[model samples]
Target: TELQSAQRKAAWADVARRIAHEIKNPLTPIQLSAERLKRKYLKQIDTDPETFATCTDTIVRQVEDIRRMVNEFSDFARMPNPVLAREDLRGLVSAALVLQRTAFPTIIFTAELPEDPVIVQCDGGQIGRALTNLLKNAVEAIEARKGNDLPPGRITTHIVRTEQHTTAHITDNGKGLPVENRDRLTEPYMTTRVKGTGLGLAIVKKIMEDHGGALVLEDAAGEGARASLVFAQGNGRAGA
Candidate 1:
């Protein structure tokens, strides 16, 4: 795996370099090609219209996913500076939920917060990325351990305010983490995913620490995991 990973990284680096070199070099009509795929002409044989739709849908969806992966790779190669300012956590989380709803259609994701605004000082873009990664990981974890055709999963976001600190707890009904990996959860280059870069949680941890906060992993109520980001409250912004 290591050797393959190294080779793949080398290949990816070369591709990325070339992408940077050739302005609009990714000129292949991949989307168009997929669109023009052969379709069964026989009306009776193709009576099941659903089959064709599914095939086309899957191809287009996966192609878009690959494009996203490449875009993330590009971003990671040259991460931009954070546009720091006051960010409304509730609104930000809501926006992320909109994005996640598409990827995890069956997973019920909810946000629980006080009516009052819980504003923090940070980069909205970076924080959004952190939230999306955590949500995506939870969804995949749940889907994997869904033993016996279990029903769809759910995630709950609870924002609590204390005298000294604000805590945001994201709880999922996915596979729970081993107690042993708790301490190592945020370690860079550490992960349980086969294709993971092992950097999502690390990036998240950096975000928390960057904002005078800490990202803590804990057990969820019934199942799954809870990643809590604890930060100083009192209406003060993060990184401000």
Candidate 2:
């Protein structure tokens, strides 16, 4: 079954590569045409100016959405192998946290990193990206929880090191994990949310695998989800 799944994913990735290559060529021209049309004729339209503006705006918006999807397809189809090296894992986590905190100022962010650096043999950029994506997902999940009675959104992060593994946990207080098909979230094109290319977790999983590690998804203590990036420690593979 795993073999079948892997084959299916390979086939889909080939299709994605072709689709991205073909679709991206026209998106820029289409967007530019729509913008030009709007800029040149917004006020000259005699019949209904508002309707003309709305139509052009819709065209531009939809084209941008398609461009985003195409980029995701490209990213998924051509994920590069991790460039592993020795680096401070805590610094990577802190960088990711700083980015997410700046992006989502309303969400309270907290970190529990140790005073000393936790060094590991891994791709610092890829690890930072994985952390950033998880943090972004957590923020989006909190934003999606629509209610007047809900408390302020919060995200917690921690980097822990043991004899066997060095792990980073990103926990959020938002919508909890889905009861069904939780494990499938890491599969390519699988998603719980309506928006997104559904490749965030999949890419993260690939990055971890490249480093001989794992990406673990689970529920938080009370609410929301926790994504753990675990790198092997003292195995002549990952940690120092």
Deviation in Å, model 1, residue 128 alpha carbon: 1.5
Clashing pairs in 1: 121-238
Candidate whose lDDT is highest: 2
TM-score of each: 0.72, 0.83
Tens digit of per-residue lDDT, candidate 1, span 67-167: 65555455454344566688778877888888998877888988897898888777888878878877877887787684687766988888888888888
Runs in model 1 deviating more than 4 A are: 1-28, 39-65, 149-151, 178-182, 234-240
Predicted structure 1, TM vs. truth: 0.72
List model 2 lDDT by residue over 1-240, tens digit each. Answer: 999998887888888898898998998899899899999999799999999899999999999988877876687687767777788888898889888888889899999999987888888888888898789889988998977989999999998888889999999998877788887888888887776788888989998999889999898988898989998886334333
**Positional deviation of residue 29's Cα in model 1 after best superposition, in angstroms:** 2.6
* Residues forming the 10-long window of minimal summed lDDT in candidate 1: 20-29
Leading candidate by TM-score:
2
